[model samples]
Each structure stands twice: as C-alpha cells, then as structure tokens.
Target: MSLVSINPATGEKIREYEETSQNEVEVILRRAQNDFLSWRKTDFEHRNNLLYKVAADLRSNAQRYAEVMTEEMGKPIKEGRAEAEKSAWACEYYAENGEEFLASESVETDASKSFVTFQPIGTVLAIMPWNFPFWQVFRFAAPALMAGNVGILKHASNVTGCALAIEKIFRDAGYPEGCFSTLVMGSDRVGELIDHPVVKAVTLTGSTAAGKAVAARAGGALKKTVLELGGSDPYVILEDADLDQAVTACVTGRLINTGQSCIAAKRYIVVESVAKPFEEKLLEVLKGKIMGDPTDESNDIGPMARHDLRDELHDQVKRSVDAGARCLMGGEVPKIKGAFYPVTVLADVTPGMAAYEEEIFGPVASIIAVKDEAEALKAANDTPFGLGGAVFTDDVEKGELIATKVIEVGTCFVNDFVRSDPRLPFGGVKESGYGRELSQFGIREFVNIKTVYIR
Candidate 1:
C-alpha cells in the first residue's frame, strides 16, 4: 500500500509514498524509544540551541515550504507562508521560554527543602491534520521537543509531503536520527501505534471521532493523550457593534484557510436588529472575494483540500437551504476544475439544521438571527463544540465581559477573529476535545511533574 498526495487544485497527482509496514513501524518505535533515553538526558541549553537553529532554518526556507503546502493541500500560498513563519515562531518561543517554564519550583512543605520538577516522559505520537499542516505539527513538536521528549508524526495522508518536510527540518537542524520521525501510514495504523509500548503519550489535532478513537486506545494502555479536535466556533455580532468592523472580522474569520480551520468562525450569531445589515455587508464582501489558483496573491479564497470535502460542504449547504435557511450568497460549487467550493452564506440558520448543528469544514458560513444580546450569547454557547469564539460590540467593556465570562470556549476574542498563539494555551472543551497545547501548560502536558523533598 502507498500513501498518495493529490493536488486539490486542478485535481492533479503530486507524489506517492510507500506506506510503512507494521514491522517497519515497530523498528521506528523501538529506535525512537532508545533515542529518548539519551535525548531526555540532554541539557536544556543544548536543546534550546537546537530549537533556535530549527527556527532559523524554517524562516530561511519559508517560501519553498509554503509552495509545498500550497501544492499538497490547496492552501493559498500567502497563508501557507504565514503558517511556516508561525511554526518558526513556535520553535523560537519554546526555545526562549522552555527552560524557565519547566524549571523546578520550590514549595513550602513539611520537608526542609522541596520542589516540583518537570521531566520528560518519553516518545510521543502526534496525529495531525492537513489544514494548517505545518503550524499544527510545530505547535505540538516545539514544546514536546523542548521539554526533552521525541515526536513521531502520523500526519494526514493527503499532506504526506508536509510530513516528510517536517522530518527533514528537524534532521537538518542537528536533531538526532530518532528525535523526530514521520510514519507514512494510514489511519488504520493509529490504534496499533497508540498500543505500542514505546509510545508514552499521544496528541491529536483532527476530528472528534478520531480523537475519541485515539483516546480510547491510549487510555487502555494507561497513557496520556492531548486532543485538539473539531469546532463549530461562533462569532456574535451585537446590535451596538461597529457594523463595518464586525462584517470585516466575520468575513475574514469565516474565509481563513478557505474556511477549513477548526477554530474559524463557522457560525455568525447576530442580534436581529443588525442581522439584515450584517448579511448585506457580508454578502457584498463574499461576492468580491477572488477564488482562483492558490499561488495567485490576488486570490482571497482557494480550493478546498479535497473534492469529497468540497462536496460534503455543498451537501451541508443544500440541507440548510432545504430546512428554510435563506441562501444569502454563493451556495453552488464552482463549474471550473479543482476541488473549489464557492463562498456560501446561509441566513436564518436555526437549531437541528445541518449548517447550525455540524462543523462545515469548508468555505460556508451559517448566520443565525436572535432577538437580543442575551439570545445571541445563548445561541453562541448552544453547540456541542467549545473551541474558540468571538463577540463583536462597540462597547468594549460589554464585549470583554461576554468574551471573558459569558462565551463558553477554549479561547475567546472581542471584536476580532479567534486564533491560536504560541504564547497562549490553546485547546477546547466539550466534544471539541480536552487538554491544552502551546505555552507553559502545553509543554507540561507530556512531562512528569515529580516532587523532590529533603528529609
């Protein structure tokens, strides 16, 4: 069996990689485990220096990496470039702050001297997705590697090239042979990998179902797992919001990554007084967006990562419209080639509809109208997902209060789009998945928090 890479744009074949056999996987696992023994013993200074080198390498080759991402999974070249730079930032962030974050902390206990120390566990398996391929892997790898753990990536098959490129990045940066590796295999092998004795923990950035499967496998093995899963994030626009600003933010949020992001604003919940105007303004912007070749800088949207995904998104739109939601904008698939999906907007979206209930992982936005701010907030938290959300209002204090206290999501923003940052802990609640990634909290996720005491 082989893992094939297909260009979502133009529907062309890019490359194929031979799948790693069970025997080969076992060899890789054993080697990673053996290397971890030495890797975990390396001093923080040594690790930090290596990470710094990796960051420099990423920036120097950002364009080429971006091209690979564009070709492999249909990301706009510009966005792909940003993803690479963001990935480099993660490496640099961890390098600069990792040692301090993981330092032993003194505690006043009965013992004369006592402290809590963060220590690496062992080999960790990262099962990542194709959307923002580079950023997702680095976000997990940077902190895990900096904290003295090795990583083995099982990236989405469609982005196999990206998986290999990442392996090369670490290798060229002076990391040991087993420090980081990419396993070329399908999802069927995930359970086996999780069951492997060498794998001490698992981290996944994918669907809720995938997370559940991995969590089950790792749980039975008594291993830790951190899952960053699906999201149907909402962006609430209150009547008092700056209409132009709210429309811009919602459009940008919904269209980012061609709306493939787990945290992208999938649902726009607007107060009824402003719903019509918001819809009108949002429609004008959506109609103006240029969708074309990902390499083109002028294009605002690109093809989705796969044709099947594009079809699925279209089906969701069809269902929503059938359920009485108004199609305010593009709702049909483009007639041209490639896995291209047009920017679609469905207004009057309500509970139990496909657009309102499920994560539409494409360039489709569902707008729901509510009577007031209280109803808007209620609608925002009415989903099974709690990944990230934003609330827009002219009143900064009200927006801040709603974002900080009212919205139920892992991360919330006021008058802006939701995003993940290296400086902040990123994760989700409810079925969106548990545990955190990035920052001090993330680095400690795969570490042993051991307490030392003196008699």
Candidate 2:
C-alpha cells in the first residue's frame, strides 16, 4: 500500500508521501549507527534536557498536532488533544526516571566487586499503529531514546503526517540528526529492515498476524523483539458490584476511540442476577452518545479509521446475530456518509459465533450472562487474546480473587477499565503478544545488561 494520509471522517486524501527507497533506508541505518557512537557517550543530564525540551514542544503545539492526528485517523478532537498531552507525559516520565532505571547495580560475586550495568544496543525499529499515533510512538521513543538507542519508525501507512511530525519532535528537541527517523514504507519492506545489520531489535504494536510476521523475521535474525498485539479483554460485573459506577465506566471503557482500543472492554460477562439491570443501564447510556465528525466537540463516536475496517466489523456483528445472538441495541451501520457503525450490544453470545471468537475492534459489546462467579471467570478466560481485563465488585477481596483467577492477560484492573500508566509495565499473553512496555521494565527491554567483575 502507498504511504498516504486519508481523512476517514470525510473520505478525502489530505496528502500523499513517497516511500523511502532502499538506498535511502540504507543511509538512515548508517546514520543512526554512526550517531549512536556519539549519542551514547552523551551525559545523562544532556539526554534529560532534550527529553524536557520534547515535552515542552509537544505541549506548545498540542492543538496543531492533535488536529493532524484527528484528520489522519478519525480520533475525536477531544481525544486527540488528550493523546498529545499523554505523549508529553511519557517524555517527561522517562526524563525523570530513565537515568535511575539504567544506573549500575552492585551485586555480590566471588570477586572484590561486581555489578550489572545497562548500555544501549545500537539502533531499534519501532513498528507502530495509527489508533493513538502520537501516544503510541512517544511511549516507545521516550524510553528507548533515553536509554541511548536511536529509533527508525515504521508507522501505519495511513498516518504518514503523524509519523513525520514525531520525527520532527525529536530533532527539534536537540537529539542528534538521525537519532530518530521515520521510514515511510509499506509493510513488505519491514522484513528487509529487520534483517539489516544496523537494526539491533524491534518493537511492534499492532494486530496478531502482523506481530507474528515481524517476530518470525526478527527471530530468524536472532534480534530481540517486544510485541503488543490485539486483545479481547473481558469486563466482568459481579452481583456485588456497584451498578451505577460500573455502568458509567463501561460506557466510556467500551466506546473509547469508538471501541478500537486493544484494552477496551469487548466482552461484558456479568452474573445473571445483575445482567438484566446492567444491560438496561448500558443501553440507556449508549443512546445519548453522539456520532459524527471527529472535529466536533460534542461527537462521542467517530468513523472507523478506514472504510474497510468498518465493513469488516459490520460483517462480524452480522454473523454473530445470524448464529443465535440477539442485538440489544444499535446493530446496523448508521445512515452516515463516512465509515460509521452504530454502537451495538449483543446478548446471548456463545463461543461458536464469529463475534465471540473474533476480536471485534469496533463500538460493539458482547454480553454473556453467567450463572455465578465460577462461570463468569470461565467465560472471561475463553478468548485466545488476553491483553487486558477488568473486574467490578464492591468487596475488595472478592474482586482481587476474581482478578487473580482470570487467565491470559498482562494486567487486570478491579472496579476500573484497563489502562496504561508510565509507572507500570504493560503487555499481553498468549496470541496477544509477548514482552513489556512502559515503566522501568520497558526501558530495560532495549538495553544490554552487562556484568562487570573485579578481582
């Protein structure tokens, strides 16, 4: 596919970009490798200063950058602004904590003194998605750059503008030229890039299929990789849960970014005693949601990032309904001009249906009624993808018990929706992908752990 930015809200081509030629990519690899020699030697204070500068620049141009993201990916303007702010937060987070995270540690060895030290491992390749363009890239950039490794970004083809803008952010913040670069290229070129001598490791945040392809190539080359793939996270509501708060959180959790988030609550597994009331309140809250142009401040649900995605999600919902699932609300695509799908709620969903089996990355929630807590836990762990999950209950001990019992996820939140924080490691298990990002654990992923000894 060509590298271009097409506005999903209006189906208009904003701009087209030429993909980087093989020769140009080689030059980038060479430059990044050469620059790292000097960049890795730079003082931690200098690196911290550059990170602070990046945070300031992101905040200064938040509106313009957010608008670019909204235009390129159909994210609501409010969410777009929030994304920009979050990007800045990540920059600041690494700036404050990275040096300490990478500091040498003393260890007891047979010698007089021995310790472990963290060091950069040359250049890294980051393959990112478009859903939260700025935030996703910055999360990787902040920690990796602070750890003294340069980055070459292979962002989603449709978010070329956002990709270029991010490259500029690092350059403007005084990172040496080529310390960070964006490669406007197709998916086919990624394998070649991975095998390049200068590219030492890879980090990817995308679908399961894409993750597997990249991991396979990186594995053959013996390069380390961190993969954050798709998720069919469960949002369980127990009988003792706070119905009022649970309903409110579900609405926001299930529909954030039009339910396109990997951590969004896709499956709603509630105990039968509370299922009826929860479903009723969920529909009532969903009815008030406004779907339209992302630029509009009042619009809650925007168009899918692309037309094909909307069609695919619609097909999944249709198949589920045909296979004995009942639509609780908003089953059909809205009569809108762009790639719009209504916020659908499906009831009586079973494992055999397409909706239950597939990751429906849209504004659709599948409700599965369970007899009790035992069955609820069983239903939640039934998916192949286990990126993130949430549990709601008034009893803290009960919530914690259920949280621990659920299998196949990176993080499980009690009485809240799944979210990423700068202080905690985030990743997934099973087909969802391996490795971690964010927090101290994330910074260590791209570094070389070296042991030093003294006789």
Candidate 3:
C-alpha cells in the first residue's frame, strides 16, 4: 500500500509514502478536468505570474529539495542543488516566452482573414524518470501550465519523496488544488492514469521499451503523447580536432550525472590516425575522477540509483569485453555495499560488441577506431538510438557540416557536448523517441492548433 524510498549511496531507508488508491485516482482525475475549465482561460500573464512564484519557491528552497534528491537517488548533492536552480530557470523561461510561443499566427487565405490559435487541451499525464527528476518535471510542467494545461505527475517510484515535494511546490505556489499532483505509485498504474478521459496527453522520459508501451496506450486512447526516451549518443573525434579540448569535453560528456544522461556521449568514434592518442588522453582525464558518496560534494562519481542498475551496467561491460572489446580501464565492480562501479573505458569496440550496439547508462566510455572520416560517420550512425551526436574538429566549417548535414540525431553539436537548453528544441530520432521537449517547439507539443477563418 506504500512506496519506499531507499538511499542508493548508503542503502538506507529514507521514507515511505502511501500509494494513491483507485478511488483516490478517480477523484484526482475529476479535479484535474474541473480545474482545466478555468485554467485554460486564465490569461498568460496570470499564469506566468504564478510560474514566477514557483521559480521563487524553487530558488528559496533549493537546498531542501536538493537534499531529498540526493537521498532518494544517488545524484551528487552539488548537482542536486543545481537541478533546483535549473528547474527555476525553466519556470522563468516559460513565464517569459509562453505568450510569444502561443501567439496566434495569421495565414494567407482567399477569405477576408485567417489565423491559427494554440490552445491547451486538458490534463497531461507525465511519467518521468528519477535520473533528473525535478528538472524533467519542471520542463514539462512550466510550459503545460503556462499554456493552460493541468499536470499529473507519475514519477519514478524510487523518488516518490521528491515527487511529493514537487507537488507541494505547486500547491505552495498557489496553483489550483488539482493543477499539479504527484501519483505515488508504480508503473502498473500508468495505463490507468493515461486511460482516464480527463487526461488528454502524456509525456514520458525513460527507456525505449517504456516509451513504446506508453505510446501504444496513448495511441489506443486517441490521446497525444510525447516521448523523450533513451539514447546511445555518439561523439566523433576527427584527425584535426584539438586533442586537449576534445579530451576534456568528451570526459565530462560521458561522465556527467555519473553517465546516467540520456543524451550523454556514450560511444567514442575516432579516426585511426589519432585513435591511440585520443584513447590515451581519455583514460588520463578520467583517472582523476573520485568515485564515492553522493553526499560528499567532492566525489566526482556516486553510486548508481540502484544495485540492479549497477549490476546491469557491469554485465554490459563484461559482455563487451567477452565480445573482443578490450577493457582499457576500470571494468571491475567494487567491494562497497552501495551500488558503485568505477569509471570504465573499453577500446577496440566494434559493431558486434555490446558496448557498440547498446546504450550503457553508466560511467563507462566505449571507443571505436575507424579508418577515416567516412568510416567515422558510418560508425556514429550505426546504432538504432539517435537521440544526440557530436563531432570535434579544428575546421569549424567542416564540423558544422558534419553536425548538421550528416549526423542523424535530434540535436548535434560541433565542438561541445549534447545538452538541453531552454532556447533550443531537444528530443531524438529513430528509436530514441519522438517529439521535442524544450524551446517554443516543446511548449506547443500538447496544444491544439485550431484554425479560424473570416470571410
């Protein structure tokens, strides 16, 4: 009847939350539908004002929220605080831009006048992951609320504590009672939530398998769905790249959030001319990263969110090594009680290996050596997952060409790593999931674009 939160760093109990029952879910659904009636008509200025209030609350109570995140999931304490700030930024961003994004645009027609208006549908069901819990929810909530849609969060079970805290943030910010609520339950309940007539759309950030299931459900219900799923993003190091800069960016790219990011550069494809140096430089850079307690701000790598996740990552590493990929460094699991794995580097990764073929969502970097730039492009686009990809080259024009024209991804970077920004759209291609989640593109994802004509 209750969901328990366990500390991934220390394997300790945080707290237990009562799961929402069937009856309670029905009430929640009703309230969301009721709230939408008035929420949809609220002026953008009024909505933005409330969003600004939410931003204020986020910054003021950032630490309190950070602590809960660090305890519930193994996110570093410093990163946890930053997540709070980032969430605040998202709120402010939506507050400032929602009106401009949803503005009615005139369309030329034979009639006297014509235009298209963007309007909110109803309640949106958000099934989010624990890796970047607060940020993901805020990114969706800020835009949805500003566009006049209500929200119902069904967050990852492990981080239900944070979910409850988020629900409190909305309530404290003076949103309507059902404007935003967290469902403290497991995945099995998601289908029921999505099937509710009041829930007009669904947005999920998780694995490909989960996205497909949710998409299918939403499709069957004839409801809109936006899925920001998994990614095995590739980063290419060309012969002309700045070795020092490439090494630094690639290290941070692969290791951010202990390598749990969906858009993190998972595969390192290097031309043979510079492959040896690149591999050497990458290993040297990662050697200094401290892997330990998430509570310690000094620790560069923390325990993974769960023991099974760590074990699964390890299995991937082992399978890759068995498939003829060489472990360049740190392939062994630790003796610690918590779910901890050292920063691993695998070289000679080819198409047949697990490291080359799958998404290894841990602090492990896999390297593949290609003969030339042509081969590098082939290697980078070899995977089914195409969430993001990047290229490093001293030739700026050439890098841009590769990043924009050649790489098959939702977002591509030339010199920098792939990251989500409030200004630009972010999502994926292939099996990574469809639909954008940031910028003006994201704000309009769940809105209804109705056409109006006057003769």
Candidate 1, residue 316: Cα displacement in angstroms equals 0.4
Could you list the CA RMSD of all candidates, in the order they appear? 0.8, 1.0, 0.8
Residue 8 miss distance in model 2 (angstroms) = 0.7
In terms of lDDT, the best-performing candidate is: 1
The true-structure Cα RMSD of candidate 2 reads 1.0
Candidate 2's C-alpha runs over 4 A off are none
Runs in model 3 deviating more than 4 A are none
lDDT of 3 by residue, 1-455 (tens): 88899998888898888999999989998999898899998998899999999999999999889898988888888889999999999999999999999999999999899999999999999999999989999999999999999999999999998998999999998899889988889898889888888899999999999999999999999999999999999999999999899888898898888899998889999999999999888888899999998888899988899989999999999999998999988999989888889999999999988899899999999999999999999999999998999999999999989988899999999888888888889899999999999899999999999999999
User: Candidate 1 on 1-455: residue-level lDDT in tens?
Assistant: 99999999989899989999888888888889989999999998999999999999889999999999999999999999999999999999999999999999999999999999999999999999999899999999999999999999999999999999999999999999899999999998888889888999999999999999899989999999999999999999998999899889998898999999999999999999988889888988889998899999999989999999998889989999999999977898879999998888898899989999999998888999999999999999999999999999989998889988999999999999888999999999999999999999999999999999997
Candidate 2 to truth, TM: 0.99
Model 2 Cα shift for residue 73 (angstroms): 0.8
What TM-score, computed on C-alpha atoms, does each candidate reach? 0.99, 0.99, 0.99
TM-score of 3: 0.99
User: 230 in model 2: Cα distance from truth in Å?
Assistant: 0.4
Ten-residue segment with the worst summed lDDT in candidate 1? 326-335
Encode model 2's per-residue lDDT on 1-455: one tens digit a residue.
36778899888899989989989899999999999999999888999899999999999899999899889989998898888888899999999999999999999989999999999998999999988899999999999999999999999999999999999988888889879999999898899999999999999999999999999999999999999999999888999999889888888888999889999988989999999999898889988898898999999989999999999999999999999999988888777688888889999998899878889899999998999988988889998998999899999988887778755589898998888988899999998999999999999999999999999
